[model samples]
Target: MLRIAVPFTTLLIFSNCGMPPAECEPNSRRCEGDLLIGCDDTGHEAVTDCTALGATCVPQLTRCIVATPMLQPDAGQTIDAGEATDAGAEDAGAPLEDAGLPDAGPAVIDAGTPDAGLVCTGAFPTNTTAPAMPPYAGTAYIDADAMQATDPSSFVDLTYAGRGVRTMFDRRTNSYNQVNALLFDARFGISKHVEIQVNPEFTQAVAEQHARFYAHAVGQLPAFLFRDLDTMWIHDGNDLFGGANRNILIHVQQGRYLAMYGWLEEVLLHEATHTSLDSYHLNMPRWQQAATADRVAISDYARDNPMREDVSETVPVWFFSRFRAQRLDASMLTTIENTVPNRLRYLDCLGFDDAILP
Candidate 1:
């Protein structure tokens, strides 16, 4: 026999060459940079680069752990991932607390409903009709028959509890028909309380019946300018004058009253101011003297009664020409400012100068 001698160590290695590799427990894994080195189901070591699967290994879990992205709120805000529960000293799987990490409390969140009144939709209702007027028989000076004979449709009755006013149009001409538009403009243009409290009545018949007629009769002048005049007449419960009751009558006719003159809303606002001031008896003789001493008249009408008409005339001018900056004839503005510097000063004193332009 041929001599084939082998060492004992060589013989042992040769005997185990056909056997499989050592096996590991389930989920056994380790981290290597961005890779996951773990044991597969077959007990073979497998290499998986976590970066290839859009993940990174977290060293806290020891095994190949993947990191989860956290969402961020607004600037300077932080999100709480939640507090880690303590597993107690008896649990073997509990993670040790890191001494470098700060203690965190539970996050607080507000979840209350808001009040309904706080919401502003900016929706306002449209006003269609004027308030109704109270019943009143003509006084000794006012012919009840003629006043009653005036067309009902021509009158816009406005009433608010104890106070009431009837705004009648010119029965002779169709001009009064346009009073509705003027009223509509005035209603929205000024304060609701002021516009309603002023309670001005426009009636050519009433105006002519009283001594306070238009400067030029409706048919007497050109169709536009001199034809329409808004006359503010004082009335008692009965007569146009010499009455203790404080009431106002506005005499006007239709046809471009606002466009041609730029006066409708302004004039209404002016007269309403007058009605408001009249209650305080601010038009006393002393007040008149002081006004005359300080301010000059703006127009011939205002000149006729400076103390009385100054506020009315200048109010509209100040509101439209000055405050609102509405385009007006330069000459007119200059004339008003030059002639009635005192009136403007008076308005300033009364706080009327601080009008907020619409």
Candidate 2:
């Protein structure tokens, strides 16, 4: 009887330089001195399961090969696979600290300093409808006349809820309008598996209208997995801001919620992803929750929470860029892969892979 050799645990191997058995049916054609690339995460090496533990084996010549690092850090960045994230246990939702640590509650950024409430702000380019998601009028149940104003300038007056006693930040032309679009798309995607609810606390009057649309869009999501969507766009007149338990509260500046809404839309999709994960599985640590969700770092929420943001950012990036036309830099791609080892799991949770983000 002849058999094909399986990969062995040890990198080095010693074997007689004899031709493979003619009846063995070699896996591939061979060369006199062909080099064998070690198996790693990028691809799999054909092998036979010799034992129940699924031990792999393969015949080798007299050479010991060093195990290559599974993940290689790019320049100026480091990849630490075993470095567990500092989250969930005591610091589940702790605020990010400036000194590479997390604060007890939340990080406070005085927003008004970023830009004038009416103009596009932040370091990234702004004022482009290309990134602007369409306003949610009929879809998310947004108020048509209000949230979807014809004159884009109407977005200038939208409210944001992130500011505390300190000053707030300004947003772009159609922040809230675009945000409504993102929320609608994400909600619909995740609603397939998990029951979901939305709570929009818009502090601005125009944003209040968008909140209404958001609530309306809730009904449009898959009825089976989604139980309901609840929104609170209007402030209860409360100024305090921090991470809340069981729900993700976005803090857009009052009067800038519209433009900020565009920014917040990505975050909303990310957070809402948590709800979907919870429905599919049991209670997991916040860090793992974000990891399984596969969010990326481009969004503000994901950037602040690197470990958790992995899934939240990944879904959007993959759906929008990889499967869709959107493109992400090499760094972003690396983050996505290292974050989630199982592509099937990530793609499975997000529903169909094509036409993911718009």
Candidate 3:
């Protein structure tokens, strides 16, 4: 039996030395006695058997290589096995940290500019001229002839005509005409300007025309008391006129002309006394104080509202005895002087005694 014995140490040395080198310097490779020894291209540094990994060595690359192809190298350049070529290298001047990656910072954004247009140059204009005068002058253009030709009294008579009961003294078309005439008579009978100043507009309507004269007399009373009489219907059943703040209305049951006129004229001065004093401060608190100081009233009406009617009622009696020489049955002046002496004193303070008598 011609058997050959091999040492285990020598067999181990042969096994390792026959393996290829995975990595090599440029243009270098491992070699054995009649064969080339190379490594597989596994991107690692290992001594691998080329035959076992099915790879070969390339002297031009100087590496143990595989049959798998790589990217072509640049002209006149060589690369080592298991080493990256310029084919997959970063750009020459690019940052190595950002290789094969997107930019890791904020992007730049652009915004454009603005434009402005037209400007004003000229100065604003203003008015330097004066305004013109008004065209129509007041009252100067009014025609006096046209005004006088139109009678104002006739117009007033026409307004109240046929409004109420017609009296014996009233005309067919003018209801207050007779009353207006009596007012004019009473006006002139007292003084020329008395009607114009005291009661300029006295025409009014009544239940009958014969009552017109009496209505004119009642119109001569104070505006305030007259208002009270009208609101209270003081003369509703009598033939006397109902009083208003501005006018009067007479209640007439009988149609006697001259007789009614006589009675109205008799009372005209009495009511006129009230109208005259009323032109002063008859409605003031001072008048009330004077009436209170009197302490007694002259008539039933004065007794009822001494503060309101005392002065009107007392003044008339004083006037009749002092100026008209008419005898009153009530002897009201003597009664006022005896019972309420301050009443006489108040009338004297108002200069009524001198004013009526003188």
Q: TM-scores for all candidates? A: 0.30, 0.30, 0.32
Best by TM-score: 3
| lDDT (10s digit) by residue, model 1, range 23-128 | 6554355667865555533454444455544446555533222232211110000111133233221221112221111112221111222222221122212212
Rank ordering of all candidates by lDDT, starting from the highest: 1, 3, 2
Model 1, position 141, has a per-residue lDDT of 9
What is residue 352's positional error in candidate 2, in angstroms? 4.2
Q: Which parts of model 2 have CA positions greater than 4 angstroms off? A: 1-210, 213-228, 231-233, 236-262, 279-314, 321-331, 349-358
Which ten residues in a row are the worst by lDDT in model 1?
A: 2-11
| Best candidate according to lDDT | 1
Candidate 3 residue runs with Cα over 4 Å from true position:
1-239, 243-248, 254-270, 273-276, 279-281, 324-333, 352-358
- Model 1 scores what on Cα lDDT? 0.29
Whole-model lDDT values for every prediction: 0.29, 0.27, 0.28
